[model samples]
Target: MLTLTSPVETAFHRLPAGVKLGAVALGSVLALQVTSLAGVGLLLAGLAAAYLSQGVVFARAAGRQISGLWPVVAVILVWHGWTGAWAAGAVVSGRMIFAIGLATLATMTTRLEAMLMLAERALQPLARLGINPKAIALAMALVIRFTPVLLDKAAQLVQAWRARSPRRAGARIVLPVALAALDDAEQVAEALRARGGL
Candidate 1:
């Protein structure tokens, strides 16, 4: 199968689930300590290397997502530079992006069942707080599973609208897309309930 999950994800999947989670969690924590341009640059370079090492496909996907957000990043950098806070801001932004990319890689590699298992195991200590960890994990898995479906449906609606009219899409198009996606979500929920998900 042509896979959305890249070789990086596949490799991460072989590690114990806890290890994958820890890598992301630890990386996130370390991001806070980066407060210089050098730090941010190094972090970005390392993340790029990691993604590239995974495979061309993963690197492409990561590049596209990062590129799409370049405008936002530029605005942040400019604002911080004006305030003489460029170093701190860049570090914060770079770490957040890099950590997210890594964590996403983990999710792409790990199956839903494995994610749930890890979630359940992690939440075990909190069970005494009246939290149903399994339920929470299952809910998260469902959300993850449906996110891309929702995005694709919305994209399709936008394409259809663009085809029929040359006018720029506005809130009118977005509102209907949201409603349609909700309806699809409802249908999915019904199916899941029938299968004892509820």
Candidate 2:
């Protein structure tokens, strides 16, 4: 979906957004209960099967996204190993990753418009709390719209750093990525303001 525009995405886009969001949320919450490596393994396999059956490019995207969180994973592994809580840490980490992976798959298999609609319906009950569900939905749509843009910018920054690096420091890469992300944020703000969202 990110690399090319395809019919699968178009088909997924026609589904009710609320239904897709519900599925994603339910899958994520349920996945938390599965902590064992075997369970997570099975979940991954299931996701892969679904991805293949649906012809969605989830495996590569999910792998790229998951591997990007290795720093956090590394910290948890070291802390747990040293503190003698490796099993607990592993369970927490696995479940967290599983939820994220499943959620990503859900998004990849669904459409943004459907997601926004689902979010609006889901938030409808909160209207009594002084929340306008439609406004919240629009905000969510804007976030989803920009998430890919930011990701693409980050990828470009990484590639540029790799092209120039002999010894790449974290700060050198992160600083530029952060600045680019902030620029994207400013553009998003400007877009919203121009559309009267501000």
Candidate 3:
């Protein structure tokens, strides 16, 4: 699995994972409450400044991670445009972009182990209910880690499709991506079993 954490150290990397995660959660909530285009723009500007503070390399890496949002944004804009609600579309898109940016920043700065530890601690109380905190935390960590891997797989499929055909891959790659994901899951399950199964 490819880790989202950047190899280049930054000031944000020194912060506790819990704090960073909490901040992202709070920011997401606030972003959702924002309805005005101006408000969303201000928040996005602040987020951009935060990224800039981390240095060019770190900011560029974060931008690449969130680049996946473009398609979704385009869909949102198209739908809103058809409905004649351009302002609403812009606000919605901005809020989503800001929330994802905040999350990407946190993920890029924090280590997977630290996030797992934080999750485990947060879920400790659930242990009394016969729920394994370690297992739950590990599951959460794996989901975070594999999301980008799946996206990369989809990208690879698209590239392969383009290599042979002039047309876009579009939905044609869905089945292949699903099968690939299943294969990955099976391998991961086997690896977990070998390591004393979560």
Candidate 4:
């Protein structure tokens, strides 16, 4: 599985995964309360400063991870523009950028093992309800790890489509991507079963 954790050591790398996760969750919730463009801008500025404090290389890596948000932001902007709600669109986009930035930062700084451990710990109480915390944690980690992989696969499909056709791939690639994801899942399941099944 591909890990998002950065190799460059930073202050956030020393912080507990749970702490970073909790902070991101809280910040995301608070970000939703911010409806004003000025407030969202200030929040984004603070987020950018945090990234900069991590040094140029780390900041660039973080920026690249969040760059995928541009497509979603464009969709949001287009819808809001059609409705003639420019300010609302700006505020919504800013808030989303801030939230995703914070999440990307946390993921880049925290190790997968550390996050899995934290999730297992947090879900310990659920074990009493016939739930398997380790399995749950593993599932969460797998989702996090595979999300980028899936995105990369989709991008590759798009590129391949463009190479063969003048038109966009559009929904044509959806089935192939879904098939690829299912194939990956089957392999993972087999591996887990070989290791005594989570």
lDDT of 1 by residue, 59-140 (tens): 8876665565677678888998999997766876787777777776665566667768888888898889988888788777
Off by over 4 Å in 2: 1-16, 55-58, 148-198
lDDT of 4 by residue, 12-58 (tens): 99999888999999999999999999899999999999989989999
Q: What is the C-alpha lDDT profile of model 2 across 147-179, one tens digit per residue?
A: 787778777877787788866645666777778
Candidates in order: C-alpha RMSD to true structure: 3.1, 4.3, 2.5, 2.0
Top candidate when judged by TM-score against the true structure:
4
* Candidate 3 Cα lDDT to native: 0.91
TM-score, ranked from best to worst: 4, 3, 1, 2
Residue pairs with clashing backbones, model 3: none
Q: Among all windows of ten consecutive residues in candidate 2, which has the lowest summed lDDT?
A: 1-10
1-198 in candidate 3: lDDT tens per residue? 566787589999889998999999999999999999999999999999998887888888888889989999999999999999999999999999999999999988888888889889999999999999999988887787788899999999999999999998999999999999999999999999999996
C-alpha TM-score for every candidate = 0.80, 0.66, 0.85, 0.88
Local lDDT at 184 for model 4: 95
- Clash count list over all predictions: 0, 2, 0, 0
Q: What CA RMSD would candidate 1 show?
A: 3.1
Who is ahead in lDDT, 1 or 3? 3
Question: Candidate 3: where is the Cα deviation over 4 Å?
Answer: 148-176
Per-candidate local distance difference test = 0.74, 0.69, 0.91, 0.92
